[model samples]
Target: MRLRSLTLACSLTALTLGPVAHAAPHSGHRDATTAASAADKKPRPDDTIIAVVNSIPLTTRDVENRGKLFALSTGLPVSGELMDRLRPQIIRQLIDERLRTQEILSRHINTPPEQIAAAIAGIERRNGMPQNALRDRLAQDGVSLTTLIDQIRVQIGWVQVLRQELGARGRVSAKEIAQREDALKRQDGRTEYNLSEIFVKVEDPRHSEDELSFTNTIIQELRKGAPFPIVAAQFSQSQTALDGGSMGWVQEDELDPAVISMVKQMPVGAGAISNPIKVPGGFVIITVNGKRVIGHQPGHVITIRQAFLPFDAPLNPEHVTPQQQQTLQKAVKIAQTVNSCEAVAAINQQNGEKRPSDPGELQLERMNPQMRSLLEGLPLNKVSRPLVSTDGIDLIMVCSKKEKNFADRSPSEIADQLMNERVEQTARQLDSDLHRKAMIDMRIKLKGV
Candidate 1:
């Protein structure tokens, strides 16, 4: 009996079946680690050329196939817009695969031929099919079984690499665990919200009967055909009214008691607009749009950015006005004006300080509550304003956001995840730093295509 690799076959990806039609014109991958399309490769016609990254090329066929899998896994519709947004993620995955495989080859990390054959045979047995059944499916799907095996091998190799490289970086103090336990018990957990808010400030809930009717009419329109965001933008008196009422995700306990009670009754995929609820300055036509309970899995969420700051590379410290250095309020303004990481780099360059090759990732929760507050409120993809940190002026950019659900630990899984997380950060930082140091040339050579 061919036992299937549950990790590979039962992934959320299996849901997205069928390939997408390849679009013409390939886009180039900008990263140095991008893979080249092997297209002239196997014979296929539905495929079109996409962009190239470095020497590597991505074909339309590859995107369609991978996109279908990614879409199915995420349960999101495969819209062109979403596809474009996912391009960076796909490219990152491709780069990771390429880097991993390249490392495998260099490190002589080869899987035994018997292991491969056995795995395939096991999968065939699980499905109660002949060995040729897989070959036949591959033939029909235009995907190779070998290709899947290679991907799995790369994933295994990456894990091996992490185990070796990040083994030493894993350690948690008793103090940290105690603090985590305390936070779990007393951090006010998060407030949950079952909110369908018109978002106007309320001076009174029962204004003119006309006001109530007008708001109810808007709610009805939303229930029928009008988009909530569109209406919220047109009528919401809140500061973010122009943003179309995208409150993003809200936890349940965060809502008013009445609002929370109403939302608890609403179903996940459906919601209803309640009669205008009384509030301060204005009446809220509570639309129980969606509700989620407040609480997060126990584990610290850290937002880290890393680049090794090189003390020997260069140095140019800012000539701060004595006036600016002494004052807290003045420094806050200076922090807000700093834009991207590139800006910070430029500032470092100007200060003549050698910036580290990889930035450091800071644990967000360790910061002052006020600092944590700012970071939490911002979108994940955005950078934070520099805060007057005890450690000097601290600026932050998020790398990957991970929440460890504290409850499901078998000891091994916890150690593995903790080790893996550190290893991932270490790998990124070390690779970036070492790649720069290993590079032979300082200048780019331009060539005509």
Candidate 2:
């Protein structure tokens, strides 16, 4: 699979699976690693079974591992009390995963080792962790890397199941694309929001209280500087978890009635997490990235080629290092000699490409005033003087600049959106059907979890 597809799939897969728990001690609670070790030292003949799905047993050890994983992923303190509170949701998630895994095997879906490796790699890349660092992190926490790999296998296979179920409906025709485009065009002055969300599902009405408690804990972590995307990937029930809970741009009418007023009132740039808003299935936590008038906002889309030279140390205005001086001189020479974007790219390659030569299409209006002012007057193909920063100096060449409506959606994007919607619907339906047919036996009380 392509890296982007795998990255998206990796996030989608961990929606219900918690990372492996760390054994580290936290103040004011019984140590998780110690507790696990104590249990291991017990005279029990075999690991106690907690649940059974399709005649396959899930053990107390499994529950502990999942609970610990949840704690590790959320930065929550690991304690027996916390595990007790998390038990119900953890078991429910495990049950759903078991059902999905069973379905995957029945369908004979194959997720090769390479694909799983790629997914793991993608996870590290997104979280800014280095190669093999995930495995190392899990190991240090006293958990096996297999804990994550198994979850990814199920998620990748489940995606295939949904695609297979979708059949021809997965393909969106030109007519449908045209219809969506027309609808959006008609919405021209109406406001639309760019939102990200985390959906905590309440599977049974009787257990709503437990789910709400879980949701609140998640919100607390989010507000305390935990990464939203990572949290959503691990906990959200919505399919948008695949895209880090991104809902993309949606009009007010598209949101739940309860969410509309809240989103409308939210100030942009607050990065404020919403309270648990009751929705059709469960509670939804949302954050607004931005809001704009539909099809009305217009701005220039600019593409530039840049050559960046790095300094061995951070630049100091009062005490410049020799390396910094040499880097500036190199930047000046490249800027003076470079006549085209290709030439700039070549220079960047020669400098070991410390930075990307092409920074993709940038919205000119979104840039800071200083950068915007410099670019507005910059002529095409002429390299600008060095743009100094603490780490490096950049020589820029604007390759293309043009005005366009930012709100417009391309046909391919529309098609993907429609497909994702259909897949999400199919997933919920299939999950419900699996639960309806499966015989799951809970042995939680007997296992004392």
Candidate 3:
């Protein structure tokens, strides 16, 4: 069975890949007098050095590309004003990323090309795009594919660095697992929250105000319906940014005291975005996706294998092409003849495995009524009728079904959770050390930014 792990989150991190490169005057320029005189002499955004991390020069072009990336992720209409607004934060993030990148290279951490390809493929799959569609999308928007490749490379390498730093602590002990399990048992009937977060760090105490302003700006955009996961992937300082800021089910004691009170007061499923709340290292923006009573929900968990045939283009039922007709005919033959999940899996493999054959254990109660009803009566090992959609057809087979406590965590789950907590802690400490030791030079400064 494919279970959720840190790898999945790392793959999803590539979802932040975005569009275009732009040049605009922003909050400040380091050599203000020179910039002003140059602009007066010849007005345009030049490819001049904007900053330096160690000896590496960060140019106006570099910052502009990242600004455009942030714009694309928010799905907002790109404008000169928006680029200007995002400049300060984007510069700071890039500087920090440069520090991490340098550290990764110093340690000789190599991110295999296939790993990056897999992550990019994962991005397309999760975004509902066809294979290799990301490159096309980037091209259409004039955004360089290298922008995405570079960011994902660093993300993957940094994960490896964090794991190495964890040393033996990376492996959670049985005693620790038992203790967590006991704690869960003790908290039965208490409230558990399903939450997501975006953390914006303040690098220097003197720039706390600047960071807070940036946080407020992000909150404003999020409240207007910018996808939180995409924004988090682009900007959050927390390691959970790789998972689109998902915190899963967390309890009262697991959260910071400042955050606990705000989350407790927020209504679940209301899609409420919290105002910036101060924490130890940074400010946090939170949203409550749901809340559930611990140990109270019991439901059917099912495993299924599916075969998917993809359409060359979105299907037009009234104007079916010859290729589409043949695809449907092939699907019909498979549905009629395939008797086992293994057969369906084989069929999927021959079709290039456009989608995974096994989608893992699904919680039946969480599904919509139409889907839950369909699966509840589907006989085990039976090939389902072709489920046609605009872009693909699916044939599913239910392999197993069982009723269990949804709140309970398996030993492996507990272990992964502990490992994640440790990894996040290590990542933060290492990042701070990198910042403290790194030499950074700001070439531009903003007047009122």
Q: What is the C-alpha local distance difference test score of candidate 3? A: 0.75
136-226: candidate 3 lDDT, tens digit per residue: 8766765777777778888777877777787777788889999999999999999889899999876555557766777877787777767
Query: How far off is residue 30 in model 3, in Å?
Result: 15
**Cα-based lDDT at residue 292, candidate 3:** 79
- RMSD (Cα, Å) for all candidates, in order, is 28.4, 6.5, 4.7
lDDT of each: 0.44, 0.72, 0.75
Q: Which stretch of 10 consecutive residues in model 3 shows the poorest summed lDDT? A: 22-31
What is the alpha-carbon lDDT of model 1 when measured against the actual structure? Answer: 0.44
Per-residue lDDT of 275-379 in model 1, one digit per residue for the tens?
Answer: 656554555555544333334435556544312222221122454444335443433554556545565555444432323313455545446687677766765
Write down the TM-score for model 1.
Answer: 0.35
lDDT for 392 (candidate 2): 76
Could you estimate the TM-score for every candidate? Answer: 0.35, 0.74, 0.85
Candidate 1 stretches with Cα past 4 Å from truth are: 1-6, 12-95, 114-132, 170-179, 191-417, 430-449
